[model samples]
Target: MTPGTPGNHGPGPGDSSTMTTVESPRARVLPWLSTLARLVLGGVWIAAGVAKITDLDASVRAVRAYALLPEAVVQIVGPGLPPAEILLGALLVLGVGVRVGAVISTVLMAAFVVGIASAWIRGLSIDCGCFGSGGALAPGAEPTYGRELARDGGLLVLALFLVRWPAGRWALDAVLTRKDPT
Candidate 1:
């Protein structure tokens, strides 16, 4: 038995276990940073989803402009993406299964990066339609591939951060974990 031992009452016999909850500065700060990441990523997803959902036909046209997929896949993905983005955004914002949400976000960002790069490389003058209608740019209007890629790249980083640190303040995960002893 020892002073640090668990279940000890002043003095105890056969007590060999101990518990500690001390956290380093980094540990304390990480959760808050993760919270920021979750909010930003979630907000982006929700905005993107809402924008596309409103004009599904335009969304489909945007996808078709990429010329990356067959018409069949484009038909399904164009319509389905908005809802999926909204759901993912909701989960992240709510702090429910954040790791899962972040992972999904990461994958989507990567796909978008690739798609954008492909379009740029192929010399297509298309609006990324990331936040809304994705189609061809106006006549003689330059595509802002560089800025678009940078934005998605930043979002991808946020997703990776959330995946690494899912726990955060003001999240359902924290509240639920607090209730569970384990």
Candidate 2:
């Protein structure tokens, strides 16, 4: 078998073009999925943060309504949460330190889940205040604990997935790691 022959189609003296890279289907799909998850989670965080940051007092009141924390603690936490969430969201959206951001996201989500569950168990009819100022519901309004939990659960899964596979296409991490970014 000679060069260019069916069986002799190996790389030539100066040509590596004949050398092919074979990838499974999963390889082509996982990164796209990861990118989607990153964007979704990041966007959610940013929106939630923006909403609460606009009204610090309302944010404080929301935390106060939970009745799960001391007044002193709530004072600090209420004011601090918006900025922290915004930072985390920016990290995720920019794909910088993705795993760390995801881990933080997971922790936050877990805390939210516990808070919502606790409110439901304690017969508290307060709003979760996830996206905006959460506090007592209107007289005729009902709490949507179940729906909030489900949404948070889904976001938690997305964060977990990002933690497992932090690298994705168009991500800064990919450039920093110097992998086959495409």
Highest lDDT model number: 1
Provide the TM-score for each candidate, comma-separated: 0.84, 0.83
lDDT of 2 by residue, 1-182 (tens): 12222332222222211222445566556666887999999999999999999888888989888889999999998888988999889888888888889999999999989989999999998999887745757678899999989999999999999888765555666445544335
Off by more than 4 A, model 2: 1-22, 179-182
- Across 25-96, the per-residue lDDT of candidate 1 in tens digits comes to 665566668879999999999999998898898889999999999999999998899999999999998888
Clashing pairs in 2: 129-134
Best by TM-score: 1
Report how far off residue 116 is in candidate 2 (Å).
0.3
**What lDDT is reached at residue 47 by model 2?**
93
